[model samples]
Target: MVLAAPLAPAAPASRAPAAAPASVGGVSAAEWTIRWWRWTRSFPDGLEPYLDRDGRRCAMGQDDDGPVWFLAGTDGRFDARRRCRVPAGKHLLVPVINMYFHGPRLGENAMSCAQVKRRAAVNNDYLVSAVVLLDGKPLARPERLISRCFDPQAERDDAGPDDRRGVVRAAADGYWLLLPPLAPGPHRLSVGANYGNPDDPDYGRMLQNFEYELQVGDPAI
Candidate 1:
């Protein structure tokens, strides 16, 4: 059987009780949603407030490689997409996963905030992994750079609210990864999701697994 591989080592257990309802956590899923929403709204200028094609809130940045995108979907949907065009050299890749599905309508896997927090704190249960390949050989692992939170110290004050540097959370309630440089070519990138609590009503309802093909540096791609 395939096991979930986390980029970072397991974090300490969250203070919230395990297996409790979404509302039982120290911060309810709904409440966290509202908090995240308000925080995102106050984003400073040039923070590039916008939704990805899939409706997830995201910001844009740049490294020595090229453009970098960060997704922090308030709804926990965490869906986004873009055109295929690999940079000339190594680039950073950040993938976002909001385990606390927050929205007007609760999703099947919408469980107690504590459970979500636990998933973030102890990611062995819920994880998002990626595999990058060029010419049929693996190039990157999900562990290149992973985090459970977007902004732990609220570093937006120091880095500017719109800066991508402060967008990481300290807890495991969410997942983010900064991958190493990927070679330019016909690369195959796959992002897979396996999240949820078997004891919860929404178990197995939130799992996702998919792949994409990118013709790097190719104008016709």
Candidate 2:
């Protein structure tokens, strides 16, 4: 009997990243992140896409009548690869490393929208690096893609009534990308980001890294 040599794993296929429009469906990339957050918080605990291990739950909280499809980053524990089927002619909204904050901490009476916005912005302050790739080509100036929004009326159906005396003030900040509709075919999307000062002794942690193997066409095909 002859013994065979061990085979090495192959990398994912690559192509140059396609050019994406500044805004799609009249929504800027910044606004899309807020919309993504609203969509994200709409789901109950186990059903939210951010906590999904595989791509099975990718379609969980999506609207059947929307112009954009939202992709999620994992819970930052490990790298996740998701196999998703995206409908043709739909723009893709991806969250690289985003943060949402709302509060009156433990003993506080109230928190303003500006206070919430500042708290949320802290998570992105020490960003070590963030990247978004199509195929394998990296997007330019990812640091410049930062967005911040304060929503005074933000509410989550799954989370019951607002805890802050009906104020419902909250904020979100992070790096977000809005990609134009891709051609109908198989394509690869990669998104990742890490925050915290590298000089700190405990700074090796990463926020999220996701790999999506997407089929842009009918699933029955």
lDDT of 2 by residue, 24-87 (tens): 7786677667678777777787677887767888776675567789989866676788888888
TM-score of each: 0.41, 0.75
The whole-model lDDT of each prediction reads 0.36, 0.65
Best by lDDT: 2
Instruction: Return the TM-score for candidate 2, rounded to 2 decimals.
Output: 0.75
**Stretches > 4 Å off in candidate 1:** 1-83, 94-135, 138-141, 144-155, 159-177, 202-205, 218-221
lDDT of 1 by residue, 171-221 (tens): 334443344345567655444444444554443334333333554554322
Candidate 1 has a TM-score of 0.41
The residue pairs that clash in candidate 2, if any, are none
